[model samples]
Target: MGTWNEGAFDNDDASDFIDDLAEAPDWRTVIQMLDHVTKSAGYLEAPEGQMAVAAAAIVAAAVGDVAILPDDRRDLKAALGAPPQGAVALARSALARVVAPASELDELWQEGDDHDAWLTQIAALQTTLSASQ
Candidate 1:
């Protein structure tokens, strides 16, 4: 039998590292993608369960991305053309949920720390509304 070395697959060359980093979606991109999905009629009509999963993934990714950024790097107040209260609160809430160290999927799901799941669900609804235009 061949020797099994777990670290063999873990070596990341520059290109590989870049590619991996590229695959890590940005919060803005995740939000945009979810917006697109929600706008699609097929997505809107998708079963509630499917929609929920997609929404959760988007929110989780967005929260995770934002959480890693320093306060100085975040400019949502200007970019969003709105006061920062809502966005800040939303980000804070989502970050709390996304950063939990729960090891099990169910535990993560049940934690509901930041209400990221709820925010995602709301986003999906907003997407549906926008798509109807």
Candidate 2:
């Protein structure tokens, strides 16, 4: 995980995921990424958690939570339009998984001095996602 900060798209995997979405902006891609994280049976890798965060951010943006998104990605709100209710639900689940036990992303961050900051960012995203529900 080439993470530089706590923002959703501030890492290599997340940036790559967003780039893929930009190429063919589809809601299914967002939901699929979220599902990948939520359905993982074992420890969730850092890269998967990163991408799931990015996907959840997109779902939040799609439902008018653009303020929770990075500036460059705010346009995705228009590109993605509105996500289905299921995607919104999945986004919340995916985010919970990203911060749950066995999540490499969470484990790694917990070892850092900025873990609280990262958790705050996730919480903000979750709050934004919840508002859309």
Candidate 3:
């Protein structure tokens, strides 16, 4: 498919993206999804825009090793607009289950982390996440 564009489809909402991230069997899949969403949202330059905000929150959550803590998730999702839709109690269910390989990020990504290197990292994490399963 072509690169993502806003309003490309009726159900191309952030929730679907979020669910994709949560259901990603491995981090490689997660990065693929993130890259698609981020590229579509113009890297969140439209910070308050719906899709960008959602992608930003998920990136922050991943960098911060987020779990589905209700309070924290509430703040993240609300920042985008509203709350989760499914079973209220399971709002953060998928996120809560994420077990990152290491501690929270201490610094933002920078140069040297080129596209190829970044994909390599994602591939490695794919192995890690898959192995963990």
Measured by TM-score, the strongest candidate is 2
Candidates in order have lDDT scores of 0.32, 0.87, 0.31
lDDT score, candidate 2: 0.87
**Global lDDT for candidate 1?**
0.32
TM-score of 2: 0.94
lDDT of 2 by residue, 23-105 (tens): 89888888888888899989999999999999988887777557766777678778878797799789999999999999999
lDDT of 1 by residue, 4-119 (tens): 21111111221232233245534443243334433344323212222223333333333333332224423432232332223333333333332233312224234546335544
Order the candidate numbers by lDDT, best to worst.
Answer: 2, 1, 3
Model 3 TM-score, all chains together: 0.27
In model 1, the runs with Cα more than 4 Å from the true position are 1-25, 43-55, 61-133
Worst ten in a row by lDDT for model 2: 64-73
